[model samples]
Target: MTCPPPTATLRPGQLRDPFRLLMDVTARHDGLVRLGRGPLGVYIVSHPDYIRRILVTHSGNYIKGPLMKPFRTALGNGLVTSEGELWKRQRRLMQPAFHVRQLQLMESVIVAAVDRAVDRWAAAAETGRPVDFLDDCIELNVEIVLGALFSTSIDPARAQRLRELTSEVFAGLASKVWTFFLPSWFPLPGVIRYRRAVAALDAEVHALIAERRAAESTPEDLLGLLLDTVDAETGAHMSDQQLRDEIFTLFMSGYETTATGLTWAAYELARHPEIAAKLAAELDGATARPRPTFAELRSLEYGKRVIDEVLRLHPPFPIWFRSTVAADDLGPYHLPANAKIVLNPHMTHRDPAYWSDPETFDPDRFTVGRFGTEQRHAYYPFGKGSRMCIGERMSQTITQVALSAFTGTFEFSVAPGFEVVPQYVVTCQPKGGLPLILRRR
Candidate 1:
């Protein structure tokens, strides 16, 4: 699978600022463009067909590549990075927990978490202080994932520790272009931080796994389910290392993306008072609160559209990194074997070729008949293909529940000069917390 010679000259520059760099690069390139030098070599793929080739049609030609290894170091060979039969087996075992039907069982937990966060906002509203929506959403999503994934409650103190450690891991990983290429023994700050974070995370995970294993009675939560899961052919279950890996993967992938999406959705609503009012009206007409049940999510179509629109404009995982195992021709360009390929959903979601007024935040564009029937490659908030996010449905459910619960309880407005800048670590997140005033209706 030798790749064809490059058609366009690779550009060179010091990408001192990742956000500005990405915005500028995507603004010019029609589809795929090679940029940067050394191990930070970036190939931006914005075309729908090109994305399809990398993520779906011929996805096997790529593995998880350099971008994801820091996370892999922390999480081990779990579904997020494992390839071939290993990923398939783990994904199969984990898929049942995230099935559409199973999601209903987790709805109450999601609502409870949302309500907890909103209660704080309500308090803040009474005092006339702006609530940090981004921080609240991030914390809320973490609680939701922990509650739904494990039977027992996560100790708040321990959970806080994990959050700090996880943030450190992602922050360190985000700083460099090719931290993955550095040997694990390297004494650099990034390497040292990765090593320290890994040890801390491993210690926490092992303690939790041990506690769960020692419990005389096993229940139906994610931990118990993972314990019980066995491969059909090998009759083998996950090793301790594997268990830790999966849980860490779930924590990283499941929490950050959903949290970021929720933050953006809220930011959008805050920016447009009329839009928020319209959504609030829809919420008022659609369902009665305590909190809308998973069954009631279908009636919250407008809310779902808001989330979908957020995903389009500010996707959680913006640029996907994949290595070309075998080089093949992509449109007019010939990619060489082992070429570092980057699939840019950030640009594709806004591709003028596929979307009208691609820069606008129009939920109506995804009105019922629009989303499922639209071209698949044009929208990839959860990504595409075998390595696609396994927690997609669950994340959507959590977002819907959070939005419905929060919006039902209060009115939202962004604070003045509240700029939303995106920064990508393992996931794309708002650079600063989204500060917004929450007024009681």
Candidate 2:
């Protein structure tokens, strides 16, 4: 649809009402708006068709977009925040690690991490104490990613610090102090802190890469695969920079998104005991008192449904951007070459036209055999097309395992009068810590 006429001058930091502004633009202009003026005006595309054009049909006409510039500094042309031939190269190199069959090899590691975290929480519950599910979720998934990446268990303290550093780096992006100055314009103290964190992570990743490379054994792990991957045509291989960036990308993407999903799912279950009871019953109805395997976790359809609905309502990556590679017509709007285009899956997920009772918490809407149908096109939590999350299967599997394990052992409740509010930083996290009181089953 045609973009709304530029009515107001939008400076970078002056735009406080991102969500409301985008909603108004989408509603008034039919899912597209051109903000600012001159060479750098941002083109916001919210329509599914135009989004498809920019992200799928004519995806080559766009790159990862400018929002990634800051992250690209930390990521250094990694898959999550890189574009062009570099992205293609990294995608090819990293493709095998996320393959469904390959990911299955990491299932035991994931379950062990979940069980370890659950055991800690079980001890807390036994003492009649509250546990911050948010912290616990982050810790569990961080360990899982570390194990999968290295193909070996991680020491808890080292893993915790890594998780904290990743979150802090992204969190730095949303900081008013950080964003006020461009990374190029100045290397402020905040940027310095972020750089320090990046360097620390890089050292660890490179050390692992070196250690894995030196090992005589064929590890078959992600690190080993990355160490061995080469560009088939040119016989090119990942440079040390590429290696660190890609590993960092996988580590950040793997942990943060799953952690958010788990935290949100926990919040949902704690807020709705009836749904939790049903989910618990579904788990109970299955195998009798045993650890859930990938197969068993898949059978917890209701639990999966709950997580799906949560992802729909509170997507981890709430906003993504694409920069036009060349001038193109998208529906009624003619996007200029190099124009910045933003897509809001967060709004699309809540679009009343696509979702029934869009704002309400309704897990039943996602029954088995219903997704990928005509009715659910706007419900893309993992995004769409070729750029769809490669880690979706792995993330889904981990979520199911963690949720089923928790429900199998404990029933949880949000503390009295605690409302689970959505706070968007890098991901949609609970505004504060998601504290839940656990009653052992």
C-alpha lDDT values of all predictions: 0.76, 0.75
Per-model TM-score, in order, reads 0.92, 0.90
Off by over 4 Å in 2: 1-29, 35-41, 153-161, 174-183, 186-189, 368-372
For all candidates, the clash counts are 0, 1
- Compute the lDDT of residue 216 as modeled in candidate 2: 78
lDDT of candidate 2 vs native?
A: 0.75
Show the colliding residue pairs in model 2: 61-325
lDDT score for candidate 1 against the true structure = 0.76
Model 2 weakest lDDT span, ten residues long: 174-183
- Deviation (Å) of 104 in candidate 2: 2.2
